[model samples]
Target chain A: MHTNEKTVAKILFIVAVLCGLSALSLADVVAGNGPSPLIIFDGSKDFSTSSVEFGTVYRGPVHFTHGRHINEHAVSCGKCHHDDSGEPINDLEFGDGVDTCTDCHYEETLLRGKALEGMSQEEVIEHYPNAMHELCISCHKEMNNKTHTLSAPEACRSCHGVKK
Target chain B: MQKKNSKNMKNGVSRREFMRFLGLTTGAAAGSLLLQAPGLAAESSGATLPKFKIHTLNSTAEKIYKCKPGIKRFNEANMAFKQVGKEIGQPFFHPLAANLKKNVANSEIGSGIKVDSPDEARMHLAFSMGAGTWNNMFGPYGEGKENQGLLSWNPLYVPKDLAAHPLHDPNAVDLTKKIKQMSRIYGADMTGVAKLNRKWVYSKTCRNMYDASPARTKPMVFSDVKTPRETDGELVIPESVTNAIVFVVGMPRASLQLSPSSTQTMGGTGMGYGRMGLTAVALAEAIRSLGYNAIPCMNDTGLSVPMAIDAGLGQLGRLGYLVTPWFGPHVRIGKVLTDMPLVADRPIDFGVTEYCETCGICARECPSGAISADRERSYTPPASAGSCSNPGALKWHVDGKKCLRWWMESGNGCSRCMDVCPYTRMTWTDNYDGNPDPDKFWDLNLAPFGYQSVKY
Candidate 1:
């Protein structure tokens, strides 16, 4: 999705305030710099893996194990990541093309019924929340079916903690 | 309109919309101001300071040496002296001899000779503190013979009780200007005067430095002494010593460039301190020769950075080093406490506060992760990080303990922050001139509107 530089800076700033800069790590955190934070994406709270144009508010942290999936599960990079064209993204470097769901699939960009049906596969994924649901649930379903596993947390409460 | 509103309201409100409701936009609006909050908060509060003070005599603005209360001595409160007396770790420059032992054949670079290889030179610079000084650098440190030299100096015990010169003008600011000129000639790149800050003085000697009759050599309780007096091992500054002259000496920039790495080029930092020792000794003697009592100091009395900042040498940078406009963090500090009535210089603003907020080059390159990357400065240091960081100052604090650990890990110390400091190196985006020709590269040389080109 298209995002400007100013928007990017605001996102990083908000995240720094959220992270609670301690006297020791304040320099490393607040500056939004030092040994590439992307190297730690599920990166820093400020500099998100997906979004920059619009900021993020969180209920709880989402634990994504991309490294584990690659090394242990023998997952291919293209299985999850791709360009808007719906083509597999092969040569993903350290901080290659990545975006948040809302960046492209904001409410305005979402599609349904005739609109959803007429669009190409890549175009359909641009529908944001819908795209996130389809991608996650489908992958989980496939994984569960293959492994014959139970308790994969099919509902929102299963993955996201319900605030008391 | 209702239908469109309903369409957008599919899932409560958007995160962006919610943030707007939370009033975080105010935070966004104050971004630039917030970036400056760290440095400015303490600076603006200068006038309200009580026990601590800001001497803005001849400077552009108030000086920034917020201090601990009461008169102190040279050795007792200084961490460097404690490091030496405690013998917990090797002397900071202990590795220099070994570095020189493994030195390569001497080579020629322009007029100077490179007795050590590039790696060895770098290693030496990184490890070149060299047991500090026999006098413990700042003032009296140890007892007996160790307290000989400047440490044993007392204005009362002058070699020849020379009568005060009849022409000695205590009120003349020209005395300070002359001292500044001599300081530059004697190796200081920049110099300023401030009323002696007792709060910044050391509370006592790390070791008893009493070189007196045993009758007068009993150590007083740390709580007992108020104004400085003869108190056994604990050295004290007399009330007569009313003013202080602090100076900044340049480091070899080319040597610092190979920092965080051992290249035998690291000798620059050590060499800078060494030069400071010489400069302080000579300058102090000159001040004393003018019939004013003077005590030279280099890293021994109290914290030099605060004194340097108070003396208007530079502002504190993000990495917690003084960021001089001319030399950046690539300079050593020296001080001379005397009774001479020199006009205190006003503090300076070099835009380092704002610059370091955005520029984290030092923190980013710091191998030890000692430097903070936080955009805003903190008033205190993290607990249990390192002994090197004695927090409580209102500025960006580094994990000096971590930095020292890295120095050990690297078989020497690392100065990666200074290496990457934007002010240290001269580039298209950086400051002017080169590291050599100290007069051209040092902050003292920068913005010397009224001063002439230094003849040296």
Candidate 2:
């Protein structure tokens, strides 16, 4: 009778340990930081996951293809995502939460022409639209020059829409 | 084109040489420079220039206006006062009253009794009536009464909660941009900001013509008040109001083409006035919504032309009207004075001074001979201009009394000067006279809002 009781107790203890291990693994997957969180890198199909939409107050929203830049164009995450001091964030993995472009460069209006006449480089980059424009257009222009073709969109209508 | 170029070259002024003389080498730059220095190429080629003399030193108003040192702000009553047998009657209002019989006769002809078709008369009445809607709703004079109309000086629609906490953005640059964007959305064709020049503000409101009492006219005073307020004696503007947001609304070119014809041309003028009132009121309301004090004005409270010029909207033309780069003299000015901090735009020189000097089409086309044909600008107005002429600045002054008399005789307003100005064409086309056929006007599909976009 004693031996049977001991055998039952031993089996119950083994079952409890297995359940504890499974709960921890489930928590990891739900957190989105685990390798199990599958991020589809298809630009056309999974637009919500593959592209970042920037909503503007006075103009049309811009849709930037994250998947296409990473998978097809071979652009690393460090190219755009930067730290508070403007140092690139290298080794950025899938599902890593990042600050939006406007989070730091947060002026509501575009600053250019005479407005930017006396502003320093740092001050100029503080304007939301101006900074985004400088970043995207400069890169696109450089790419076009390198390839010797107008492949990458550089003009305002290419990103914002044709109406403006 | 080739023959003209060769002819120019024979005069030792090649196309490239002409461009170089204008301080540019490229075609685009030269074309732009031509606006600033017209007739220079002709001068080089020894062609006969216009009789008028140009202010060669500068293209600014300071150069053009030969002002007397102690020039005081003119009284509005002296110019616009309307009394039964007064020598100086209000240009727009008195003419309408004086020409009742002539107007009725003109209306009969316009209604197709004299003329075969009623198309011209119908369109004229429709445009005039439709265009006057906004101006009538909001007073043309910008009375600045509290909660009276859309052009009220006080806040109209700001909620209690929002008013309690005004916009806290410290960045004036961003605010200016937002205001400019809002102005365009509100219906302004062009927008500019300028530091308020107190000299432009009227010293006193025009008195009620029918009133026999002396108290009818109210003094306009700037005081250390929180907001603009009106009293029985005065219209008080706060000294804190430091900036003016000027707006320009373009008049329809098609309607303006029917110049001496009062029916069509008056309709165009009315349309500009109506749009100006609407834009000014809406913009003023918008600024108030953001917890800023604003005073909306249209053809009142201040001189719009000088304020508009200061705001970088345009330069003053010889016809005593604001000529914009986009619309020339075919625009009505509206303004809103506010306490909100903004970056003022710098005044621009697009060559209006030089161009107006040689282009005397406006002066020559005046049916009443109201416009001056003098070669030089003077501090004194022409003797026939009457007391309505404010003569402190040196520029060609129109004979207002004669001009008003013509309106009475014609049974409607006349815009002959506006019609014939070369700037109205906005191109290098010479001998371009717009022949307005009222019969064919209805059949043509005009652009929405009566304005057509001009692409460079």
Candidate 3:
């Protein structure tokens, strides 16, 4: 009876470890080497997670839900994560060590107005803020319009805290 | 007049026919004619002149200066000066009245008291003295009362022969360039031509601050007159004067950074006003030399912010000042109204509206809480603020009474809003830490005339 109980206990411990691993994998899938569940997009050069680490910021750092977009929204990884040929990487999975958005869209400042006047749409998306804003804002706007509810934020103040 | 007639003949359009087409015979078609006259004049000039290089970072003229759907143009009589003067029972003829009173009350050797140190007082006096020298010598209104100074409506020193035979450049494009170049040579840091918006022009000039008597105010009229004249009952600006050459004179950045009670701050503000007078007078004289009827103005004839916006100098910020991309609010505006045909510049929008929407630094940092901190803009001023604000335009209405009261109590003008603005720094790389040390100002090398070179 004692031997049978020990064997059952070992099996239960394995199952619990497996469940924890699955949860971590799901969280890591969209984290992109940053903090899990929530990612702070602050355009830091040294990849500092703290928003206050920077000297001055034009706007408040965007607090993005990484896990919620993946698990709740059921959004495909390929929708935002893409390869060099501008093609989505459909096979991207957990612990894949994906590149950050700023790694490719590397401009320090967001160029708008006359600066983007003559540039092609593809060229204009290369700026860091442009790329992120286009992806996030467009999706949020689409979701809001489709649902006929403001579940998603579409205005500047909704995403970034008012700077004082 | 003869040159204009000859040019009209060369363009194959008779003056009478052109006038008829313009509906100028009615003498009531000022605004619409003024709007359409530039393009018509350019077409008659008979040359496809190269477009002037756009100097601004971005221009969206159509999007700016549009009153909200239900709003109307603001009346000039309700402007801050007139309103404040009525409340205080004193004619607020000049901006320096409060500062002068403070000087006498404090019994300070200089124009402003230095609560911090003697260096601050000396710096304030040095800048104020320079500015006062120019502003006092030239008429504050730039009306050239009795042809006394350089701000004269009529050319003071230009030869009579030159004034009689105006330059007959039918090509407005070339003329526009020439006028802009002349303006720069005459000490304008930035120059732009904009077709005058009639709504900005005052319906009547306030002759006396508190008096509503007919003799105390003069109607600003557009008439068949060939030149701008100040008659006993009216200030007649000719209908031919359709364009305004607006320019900017930037103040010293170092001095402005020390604001909200510092004498050094007053120094910078004083210097900017002084330079504005000098530039406006010089540019007006140059325009007159070209045989055009030019009236130099420094904050007197019409509102400067709207005219500057129309001229593409800058956008209006929450502080109720022209926040230029180059100099931010640390600049003074000057203008010359003329009949000279010139291509008007499109107004610019360089993200000031968007940035100001999110950033309420100026309001938060304001010593008197004069600036509005509301997230949305409104057409009406706050009820508690009273009639100091002219409330027809859509904007963040600042409380002029509260602002002036602070100025009086502080013993000098406060520019806390101007100093704390993000645009004032023109970059987000450096953190601003309140007023900088005034003692260090004497140690740093500065540009000639105490202005900073354009950084961005």
Candidate 4:
């Protein structure tokens, strides 16, 4: 194949895999549908692991860790996330770089899209101290389901501590 | 005609031809053209957004104070009152203390310090405040106490009845306006209005009064605190007249960080206070002139803290002090409460809470360790009721006792806590040589401004 053709084929292959994983994750919600719509990617994982393009930002590759969620944690995708039809929301793709929670979530649209509603902007900013607690507690609770794990409260100071 | 049509079909569409095609469908042209610059289109339509950065200190340091907890005692080594006693033998030399002394001395000689011009007086006052009362080092804070052996104040303090002076009346209107105008004319940077919050007032037992003409000394007393007379309480001022126009006279941050001497810092505060006094006096006279009530006071009438806070100048910081964004805790405050109807500003919350949460550098730098080390909680102090505690209301309160002790030990009084405050430090940019350059010339003039600039 010509080099251009090969590059195009590779891109198509990655996109197909990302789409398939997203569909599988949302299999329960859109079980009867033609394809699941949401695509999830963990950027920190792969970039930290292998070399990738530099100087140009890229939306993280969608690595569907379906087995970990379904087999290990037994999380049915519906419990944690949702897949809907439309231009992808929350995760805006610009060239390549993906903006994270601190982006739009800083001053505007924190916990956007109905996850949290009716909170004043100040209250949402204050949410970090408590929201972080819940995230850690939930993860830890799940991990120590069978054995003892860290029992500390998940307050910001509980882990981050005070700065002098 | 057939040949010409064939030739036309054979040639590709020119720029003009493309424009002609674009005229056929507006939406299609826009859609296809937008594809050429996806990033620009995304930005314009609000698809791309900028991320924010979190300001925080070292994680381990934070954990030490919050998680790995122990009995956190308030450090009391840096007390100012105590420092006055230790430094008594030294020249009553604070620039502010000295400046005040000169006025008092002028009063003593029966020849008040005369000025050829307002500018000269201003320069003299600024110099006196910065250098302190000439060779006379004993200051107002410690002079009356027997332990200090400092007797005889400059003639200025001799006028114990300035509040009751025949030339003045709290109800004067013209006087109040004059005071306000005079204060700004003299050099106050910001002013505000608030009803006095009595909760911050120190009881009579906490202070002493000096009456020099009769050569009589008496313990300070407030009849309202002791007798609780209705007239004593209400006649002080009605809620309407309870309005106080607060003053924020800027201090040079540079001198503060130099850590020169208690005298130096006091000079800055003293100059501000002197200006505040002049304004209050003028304002009271103005009010009297206008046939209204005005209470002109630099230090004694009521508490200054809450009034300043309510005036919307700045938020109280973790150090248990007002932290103005422009000058931080580097400036001194005073006010004139009158029946003057003026507009009030709104309270601001500009991420100080988050900034303080992640940064407890003040608590660490506090010489007396008076600042709380943990998250805010409720507690009552022994001295006064209604007087707010440091932690309960989502604030970091400094332990005044520990802070006081440090002031005593430092001799000149320690502002290390205020001195090290990040807010006190000016923000600056690094030049090519990695040296910080203050964004403004005013910053270069002050030591703290320059110090903070470099540190940043």
Tens digit per residue, CA lDDT, model 1, A1-164:
12432342222121110000111111122123533211110101121212211111112334667787778777787876776877787677767657755766766432322234356766676566558657765665456334433113233322432222
User: Distance from true position, residue B375, model 3, in Å?
Assistant: 1.2
lDDT of 1 by residue, B1-456 (tens): 444434444344555764563354234223212111001111121223212111223432123434233313333322421232222232322222222222322321111224235554433332333322322343312222212355333432222222132123355566876777666655566676766656566543333321111112323222232223444455556567767788876654444444443332234455565556666766765665455666677655556766776666667788777766445676777788777777776565545676566666565555544566566666556543434455445566676544543342233334666765655532111222222322222332211111122222
Ranking by TM-score: 3, 2, 1, 4
Docking class of 1: incorrect
True contacts kept of 4: 0.00
Badly placed stretches (over 4 Å) of model 1 are: A1-164, B1-152, B155-159, B163-168, B208-231, B263-266, B386-388, B427-456
* Candidates' C-alpha lDDT: 0.45, 0.56, 0.56, 0.35
Please list all clashing residue pairs in model 2, or write none if there are none.
B66-B394
Model 4: per-residue Cα lDDT over B29-129, one tens digit each: 23212111001111222222322221222222112123223322111111222222222321112211232233333421001223344444344334434
State in Å the error of residue B342, model 2.
0.5
Indicate the residue-level lDDT of B320 in model 1.
74
Chain B TM-score (model 3 vs. true structure): 0.77
lDDT of 2 by residue, B115-150 (tens): 333444544545655655555666543432222477
CA shift at B266, candidate 1, in angstroms? 4.1
DockQ (0 to 1) for model 3: 0.01
Model 3 misplacement above 4 A = A1-164, B1-63, B68-77, B90-123, B141-149, B209-215, B427-433, B453-456
lDDT, candidate 3, B170-258, per-residue tens: 58888877766655545565677888876667666655433222224566778999887877677788899999999876666666666
Candidate achieving higher TM-score, 1 or 2: 2
- TM-score (chain A) of candidate 2? 0.61
